[model samples]
Target: MPARKIKLSTSSKVFYVICYTVVALMAIICLIPFILLISGSFTSEQFIRFHGYSLLPGEFSTEAYKIIFKTPQRIIRAYGVSIMITVIGTFLGLLLTSMTAYVISRKDFKYRNWFSFFFYFTTLFNGGMVSTYIFYIQYLNLKDSYLALILPMMFNVFYLLIMRTFVSSIPHALIEAAKIDGAGEWRIFFTIILPLLKSGLATIGLFLALGYWNDWYNAMLYLNTETKYPLQYMLYAIQQQTQALASIASQAGIQVQNLPSSSLKLAMAVVATGPIVIVYPFVQKYFVAGITIGSVKG
Candidate 1:
């Protein structure tokens, strides 16, 4: 027997067209800024100053990128530092978050609610910036340390809650069946829970990775050494120096030639954001699945 094909009504066809048109427009709106950013990055400083930004590069030049990569060694070092921090922080943070969520989500865990409340309460209130700075600097002795970048972003309560929701969705009978087969907590977690939590881990891991990769605030406060700067902070430092130079030159009644200020900002953004953008597509499926599954509560 041939399967029947369902045909859409006239109103349904019109509705579909409208939805597609709206979505396409929204996508283009979102994409326009990025297009302008790339175009501006490649545009020459003199042209940008005279003409402002355009949808496409009117005067193509790599001078901004050339100025950025002039000292290749420093750029490479910053890249290395950012990569190291992101990798280590994401791994540790994911592991700890999953473990904590698993423990809290277990029905038999005594004081689970109390612990959840404790974690939740922290989200609602904090010791403020002054106290946090003092605690990290004075007590933790993390000043000028790489740990300064990793530790602060390691355990987000929001990520913990999301992971907990994922863990809670797993059937208790499955866990009990594993226990009956003589699997200990560690064995069950490693063999069963971890494998099933792939989507959740990818989702939370992406958030953690992005946070660590883009963090310059912790660096500005705790890191005093130039050698310890991450990619983002290094770019930030470069921008600051360029602005300061222009300011000083102006005060001295001189025009700073070929400073590349406007285009340099655009170039810095491209450099800092390029790698993370590449990584997003690979984990996008898992990220979407995790968010959807974790949102539904039983």
Candidate 2:
């Protein structure tokens, strides 16, 4: 067969140009703030006061990073907590979700629909924050613990739904063939079904990992110990304290003199985000590829 020729009309070419232009402009709007934050982190304290936020620092210095790096222990501990939670939570959550999805995707299972419904109902309604907080603290007695951070968010209904949809698309003939070969349900799931669902698994796994990495709400509500704070909550407390002191020092009615408060805040933002900024590309490549392939037929 001869290859078909392709052509674009002038109007279509104009539309493509317009879309590319709009996308580029929007990207710049979003990217400028991040650039300013990074560049501002290196700005001198005196220069920051005069020039405010900018992509190009009026005067460059590393004093803020010096202060932050000097107190290495706090930053290190926060990173440890973040990594621990992110790793453990993402693995367990992915395992449970995939297993549950495998079970629910079975049409022959009489109660599969009911089970799926039971899971779906959770998204439409959830225990309010106050009740959920009290339940975790007073009933579950998980306050000031790592479990407080991990347990509440371990499994998400949304992820389960996505996984179930993906699993449902696997050919039923595959399962019937496995049964004909005398494979058990567990064996079929582990040996055959799971290997086929790698794209969906990768996408959902990344979602769960990012969720655990960025979570500070659970710690804010339940954790009391300074030692247990995740990276985000630690950053929050540091920013709050820094701002408060800067305010009080200004109350003396003198030119507020302090270490690089603005610059330090920006530096902390960079440090706190270091892991995700580094890890996102690898995981998200799998995620984008996964979403594209998964959506094609199912």
lDDT of 1 by residue, 78-145 (tens): 99999999999999999999999999899899988898889889978999999999999999999999
Off by more than 4 A, model 2: 1-17, 243-258, 289-298
For model 2, give the RMSD to the true fold. Answer: 4.8
Could you give candidate 2's per-residue lDDT for residues 122-224 as a string of tens digits? 8789898988888888989998989988877888777776787789889999999999999998999999999999877888888888889899999899889
Q: Which residue pairs show backbone clashes in model 2? A: none
| Alpha-carbon local distance difference test for all models | 0.86, 0.83
Considering every candidate listed, which one attains the maximal lDDT?
Answer: 1
- Number of backbone-clashing residue pairs for each candidate, in the order shown: 0, 0
Over the full model, what C-alpha lDDT does candidate 2 score relative to the true structure?
Answer: 0.83
